[model samples]
Target: MDSATSDESIIAFDKWLETPPGAYVRAWEQACLDKMVANIFGFNAVQIGMPQIDALAANRMPHQWLADIRLHPRQSGTGRAVAVTLDSEELPFATNSMDLVVLPHVLEFSAEPHQVLREVERVLIPEGQVIVCGFNPVSLWGLRQVRGRLTGSHYLPKAGEFISMPRIKDWLKLLNMGVSQTQLGCYAPACRTERWLARYNFMDRAGPNYWPYFGAVYMVQAIKRVKGMRLIGPAWKQKTAKAGVPVPAANKHKESIDG
Candidate 1:
């Protein structure tokens, strides 16, 4: 999608986030993110895109930031958290600098989703945690999007590509990251009204038990992996020397004379 259309879709979705279904999604995502980030200790954490929800709110990391493609003029009003405006595909951070990175629905809305993921991998330190929120393409909401495309009346924003969980996992795997968790939520159908959505709330409990993968949204947590990496120290050196064969006094004297 063109930048204009993409921005429009994002603005529209941010507004929609205030709607009943959107509100439900926000609440669920916030709770999940809060729980997920609480244990992720790091010096610097960056949340790329989706300033509509503070993805790093519960994170205890000393330095937390929210970034997007376009900087918000009134960002200072948002309080202690720093806000940056930069292209998602070309992040400004140093490679392997961030300890935690959160992408709240960034992939589905991105025009260059693969580049964006690559950028995410670039900025994260080894073993750094990444948490992503996305709409599941095999869920009730996905069906709605398909119907919308056929009829040209998208219930969700038209700009989003609505990536599937498997596709995302493949992307992470290709980047040499191990997925640690995949959580499903917002099991209700794509209802237009809040009353209907609330009435169908029972689906949240029933859907996961009966059809776990059919939720409207999913959260994926992955860790960057570096192979053949190990830690060494003075103690390890001392232990290796003790474990090796002892040199004889005659050999030692001969070696010292040769030296």
Candidate 2:
């Protein structure tokens, strides 16, 4: 898709977030993001897209920004404002400057998903963390979405090229970002209305223990790693022994004279 088309799709997806199914997904994502970012220590953090969700609200970073390709009038869940508007494939920040970056459903809608991740890797400092939320294409929800596409209707946004967890892991690996943690959620069946979703709510409780990997949504946390770099602690100097030359010479002379 072209940039204009991609932008329109993102806006559409944003609108979808207000729907019942969308709201369910949003609530799950919000809770997960809150827990994931709570303890991360950092100076600068940036959330790449999906400003409707405050991905950094629980973070304690001194500098946090929400960036998107274009500004939208909608405020985030916590009323956090967008700090900058820029292309995800080409971030404006300096290389290795960001301590954390959150990408919520960004890859699925982007025209150049790999390029977006490359840009994120470029901006993140070594050992910095990145949280990515995406729709899993290997679940019942995914099967329903596929069926919807075949039937000329889409369960999720047609513009989204839903990426699988393994694929995302491979992409991050290629960028030298190691996957540190992963979470799967939204085990309920893919239902269009709130009523059906409520009926299937029991699935959410059992899914984690029965079929954990088949959740509709997945979140991954990765840390940027640089080769041949090691952190060092404070250094200490060894104490030197005092010279015993004068005492040794005098003792030797006195022993010889006595002999």
lDDT of 2 by residue, 139-230 (tens): 99899989988897888888899999999999999999999999999988888799999998899889889999999999999999999858
**Going through the candidates in order, what is the number of backbone clashes in each?**
0, 0
Residue 177 displacement in candidate 1 (angstroms): 0.7
Worst 10 residues of 1 by lDDT: 71-80
Task: Write model 1 residue lDDT over 118-231, tens digit each, in one string.
Answer: 998999999998998999989889999999999999888877888889999999999999999999999998998989999988999898799999999999999999887586
Please give the range of 10 consecutive residues that has the lowest summed lDDT in model 2. 236-245
lDDT of all the models against the reference? 0.85, 0.88
Return the clash pairs for model 1, or none.
none
Model 2, C-alpha of 50: deviation from truth (Å)? 1.3
Top TM-score prediction, candidate number: 2
List CA RMSD, all candidates: 5.8, 5.1
